[model samples]
Target: MNTSAPDEGRIDTEVRGHLLLITINRPAKRNGFTPAMYRQLAAAYTRLDDEPALRVGVLMAAGDHFTAGLDLPTFAPLMQRGEQAAPAGGVEPTEPGMAGYRRRQKPVVVAVKGITYTLGIELMLAADVVVAADNCRFSQLEVKRGIMATGGATLRMAERAGAGNALLHLLTGDEFGAAEALRLNFVQKVVPPAQVEQETLQIAEQIAQQAPLAVVATRLNVLKAIEHGPLAAMEEFEATQQRLSRSEDAAEGVRSFVERRPAKFTGR
Candidate 1:
């Protein structure tokens, strides 16, 4: 069950039932991600496509903070790594494995605690749902540190938190409290620090109990709807509806609905 990444022991991946629990293990560094950790995460996620048993996933960290953003030694190498990539259209991919990459299929959940910084919040944006502790602090201070917050938040955060809020946070690089994060809808919910992990897993278990294919399909369609216009989304949704209707799960769902019973789906 322990599929912890071998790179720096920064990531601990374990499958409990249908849920994959991913814990950032570098508590000493406040869970700051090194290059090895990032690559390991990407590598682990890549296997999800082939692993049919993984129905849900959660990302959390040991100790207080979820992450203090990228490690200095690790981040310095990102530039070097980015520079090494063959230039495509005179631009390198912003984040490793991001350009032309499909955001993951299964729902990805996160539990953010204290002192989330800069790219720390960006990782939450990548997740489908985020649960935060009441005292969690968030910021995009890369701009204040003489760098832009180009970790995809400059473009995506606006859609989630509105243009004004995005500008205020990213442009100013100011710290925001968890209460403000909840108000802006950055996090799905905020619980006491001690309850973050429990609450996140409670939600994760609910997610894992559902029909896997339906969850994945809904996640994919919903993200597309957010990125594309409603018309384009409608087209994709129609296509998806047609495909899913023929699945055995669709039939089981209808039968269960008519029978007033819970449906047991095989993820077909």
Candidate 2:
């Protein structure tokens, strides 16, 4: 449950019911990620995707801030050397496509507050859903550091927020508040700081309560639609529906509806 990386930072993981709660625990440095921390986080995500019992993942941070960004002093040299973000034998946390890391099959919900810069923004953008505190501050300051965001920010930001909105922050490297983030469609919900984690956990729990196969399939379909086009995703709808229809969970769903009781899905 307590997975520590090198340096003083660490990633703590806790499985609550069907949810994997991943907390970044390096508050002393505003939760800035070192290489080791990144690897540890990736390992946690790998567990979530590989474990059948784990239906959803909730990513949050300890202390006041989600993260300040990568430990640039340590990372910039690697960047200059033309090295990949994820080192050898480790999965890339932000962008799965980079370095051929296995794409995550599960959904991740992110809860953020205070200063969330650079990789923090990319992390949330890569996730399925996000909950932010009203006082949250976000910035894609990679350009300011004389580097570019390779952590799916350049690709997913425009997809999530419009091109204009994404460029406004990405190009300028200016700080934006939680309200602007909501307007840009970056975060799904904005609540008081005290309620951020609770709200995120509730949403993750809601997703976890659904049939796991259905949830995973739905996410895959939506992502495919985004990437390949709606028609392509729609073409697979019949086949996907038929597959689910044959599942034991589907039978349980029908029985529960007929019996006027809640469905108890075993992810079958």
Candidate 3:
């Protein structure tokens, strides 16, 4: 197992087998993200994508709350200057226009509890799956802060939760409970507060156990359809199939099925 800390320990990362466990550690502030913390968060996600051994990532917070969103005061200067910054070796935290801004090939499972606001919601939208605590409260309250959400919320929220639901919350900046989140399709599962992390890790572990290359390809195809329309995605189907068919793991998968045994994929 390997561990890494970034931005004065604001972000903590631990590797368990093929899963990268990332936790937001500053519960004292309700896990509120300072500009530095945002950079660290971006860096952690980047590490998850860059490391070949890491097949899945679990994002959770150490405290009751996932995050209180951006620390307005700490970020005020950057906001005023209209400057965007991401950590070294990291994708842009808010703006999706940056060259490095792209979704990860591997899956990410998020466990959210307590207050999840603004960027927190965007983070969940970015994740492949979300497990929210029953007590969780969420909002996209950037309009209340006299600013708009810079994260992908504007683009992805409506895609996940429908335009009407996304607009209702984004326009009103009202708080919504976990049940409403699930109803809106914002979260995949809602469990007891204490079970959030366990449930999220369980999902991550399942994804990690899959053939890594095939897993990535599956996610990529879905994203392609979302980003470039189904026709464009279909255009690449044969290419993807041919590529995966050539992988040794694919052959092992077939053999294992024929032998009535569990497949042991090397991610080759």
Candidate 4:
């Protein structure tokens, strides 16, 4: 595990086999994010995307709670100035409107517990998969703060769940529990607080075990379908398959199938 740029709050990154475990560390403040922390996290995301050895990312937090949301005292002025500054040469992990970098091609799984408010929920909503602890208390309370969810929540939440379901929470700024999160299709799994991280890690490991090219291609296709039309995404399937079929990993997949054994993919 490498702790990068320790400041008021920091983002800790660990490379576990092919999985990049990103932890938000600041238990005293319930892991709230400062501007420096956001830059650190963006750097970590950039690291994950640039490293060929890393295939998947698991985002979690240290301590009893996931996050209480942003440190308004630090971020409010920036918001007022209409300036969202990213790292000097790093990707923006949270929202595209916040930075100049492109979205990550790789997949990310998020694990949350206790208080997950405002931007915390937005972050989870932006991720590909979510594992929430039964003790989780989620709220998209930006409206209550005299602001709106500028993150992906406004765009993604309605698409994932129904608009009414998303609006119920987004509009009223009401708190919801894990059960409601599951019902709203906001979380993939709800486990005991003790098991949230382990469960999420297991899921990320499963993704990492697959052929790296195929995994990224699959995620990209899904995202393309969401951003563009399904027909547009489907139009690229033939080209994608033609490319993947020519890779060495594809040959290994055939051999492993013929041998009736688990494939040991080198991400070729």
- Candidates' RMSD to native: 3.8, 1.9, 2.5, 1.9
Which one is best on lDDT? 2
TM-score of each: 0.89, 0.95, 0.93, 0.95
Question: Which run of 10 residues does model 3 get worst, by summed lDDT?
Answer: 1-10
Please, what are the lDDT tens digits per residue for candidate 4 over residues 181-262?
A: 9998889999999899999999999998889999999998998898898998999999999999999999999999999998
lDDT of 3 by residue, 33-56 (tens): 887777777887888888899999
Better of 1 and 2 by lDDT: 2
Q: Note the Cα lDDT for every prediction shown.
A: 0.77, 0.89, 0.84, 0.87
Better of 1 and 2 by TM-score: 2
Clash count for each candidate, listed in order shown: 0, 0, 0, 0
Compose the digit string of candidate 2's lDDT tens values, residues 184-235: 8889999999999999999999998888999999999998998899999999
> Which of 2 and 3 is ahead in lDDT?
2
Judging by TM-score, tell me the better candidate of 2 and 3: 2
**True-vs-predicted CA distance for residue 199, candidate 3, Å:** 0.6
Q: Can you give the lDDT of residue 216 in candidate 1?
A: 88
| Off by more than 4 A, model 1 | 1-9, 80-97
Give the range where candidate 1 is weakest over 10 consecutive residues by summed lDDT.
85-94
Q: How should the candidates be ordered by lDDT, best one leading?
A: 2, 4, 3, 1
